[model samples]
Target: MEALNKSFFLFLASRPSLDRFAKRWGSKFGADKIVGGETFEHAVPLIQNLNSQGLRVTVDHLGEFVASEAEARERTLECLQSIRMISAHDLNSQLSLKVTSLGLDINPELVWENMIQIMDEAVKHDVFVTIDMEDSSRTQATLDLYKALKKKYNNIGTVIQSYLYRSDQDLDDLNEVKPNLRLVKGAYKESAKVAFPDKSDVDHNLKLLIKKHLLNGNYTAIASHDDAIIQYTKELVREHGIAKDQFEFQMLYGMRSERQLELLAEGYTVRVYMPYGNDWYGYFMRRLAERPANIAFALNGLFKK
Candidate 1:
């Protein structure tokens, strides 16, 4: 039943028509709960509120898979503006972006150029930037781009999905650069050939990845809302004597709001992954697919005044 719900929402996430429709209504139907807002400007105050509460934030521009060079460049400019705003507003925030939105699919060189431009601005503003991981098809390409970028920039990080079989080896490969990684139980719909199809395996694999990455002595972000995963991280770090500064917990904004505060109150670093933009349908659907409980708020959003 859970698997069916996930597949249904995943299918909805891929429909281009629905994406367009959702954009017309703006951030409605409960998307505003998870999504920051329609634009970075709209999100600035929200960031300020989160910062006031001592919750660190990473803001993603909520887009992907651009088909044209012009559109890709526009996305790059939006990211450049976002970095500047984060500095100007003095908000405690980092930038997260997708390479595809910067031309990863159109041309690798184009994406690199766009990234260099953004990284230059990010470095100037002293904002850390993370490249968000997409699906299995782009995993290798994404990592290859990240490796190239890491060589040129120190303020850059990337995500690794535990559901994928190659992620363990990817960690070993990335260890050479001493990566600061966000480990996620990947959200995209992937083939069983490339991903662990069972939830138990996926959860267990996340623990292993968390241990391996932290023991490797790289800064890690354990991006999960599950209490079991949270407890596992706490115990593992205690056993290994890992410094509290070495890792942090990350959760999507709006989901597990209380737990986020609880972790912060307990003296643990908790970063909120806040995504904002008009292009939010795909992202919101994936959130619902990730946890069916999210559907409750989404449904509530439909009838709420």
Candidate 2:
């Protein structure tokens, strides 16, 4: 049932007409509760509010998998604009971008060029840009892009998903520079050949990865909402004497506010991942895929509408 739910929503997200319709009507069905908002004007106040609460944020302009240069360029520009907005408002947020949204499918070089533009903008404001990892298919290409950027900029970073078998090696290969990382228990529906087939194995690997990085003295983002994983991370930090600045706990915005505040009060840094844009159906669906319990909220939003 869980696998079916993920695949079903992802399939709907791929169809152009259905996606267009969702982009128009999804919020009425409760996407608003998950996605921060549809525009900067709507999202900034929310970022400020979260900042006021002692939680920093990583802002993503909702988009992915562009089929053409035009779509990719439009999406890239919006991300650049998001960076500028974050800086202008002095919001305690940075940029998180998906390469596919910037034209990885159209051409890797195009995506690289778009990245350079966004990275340049982010640097001016001293904000870091973290490249969000997608499905297994793009894993190698995404790493290639991140490595290329690593030589030129320290202000950018990338994610490593524990569900992928290659993540341990991938994280190790970066030891020379110890690039900053956001570790996530991936969301995309993936195959057993490329990803773990069991949840227990994935959870186990998540702890292993977090422990390895934190011990290495690298900046790490523990991006999970699972109570077990979060609690284990806290224990690991205590044992290693890892200061709050060395790592942060990241959760999706609006999903775990009380927990975020509790972590902050405990002196650990907490960052909320917030997505904002008209292109939101796919992003919201992925949130549902990650936590099936959210479907109840989505359904209630639909019924109320």
Each candidate's lDDT (Cα)?
Answer: 0.93, 0.88
| lDDT minimum window of 10 residues, candidate 1 | 19-28
Clash pairs, candidate 2, are none
- Cα lDDT tens digits, model 2, 207-237, are 9999999898899999999999999998998
Minimum summed lDDT over a 10-residue window in model 2 is located at 7-16
Model 1, position 275: C-alpha lDDT score:
98
Tell me the TM-score of each prediction against the true structure. Answer: 0.98, 0.95
For model 1 the TM-score comes to 0.98
* RMSD of candidate 1 to true structure, Å: 1.0
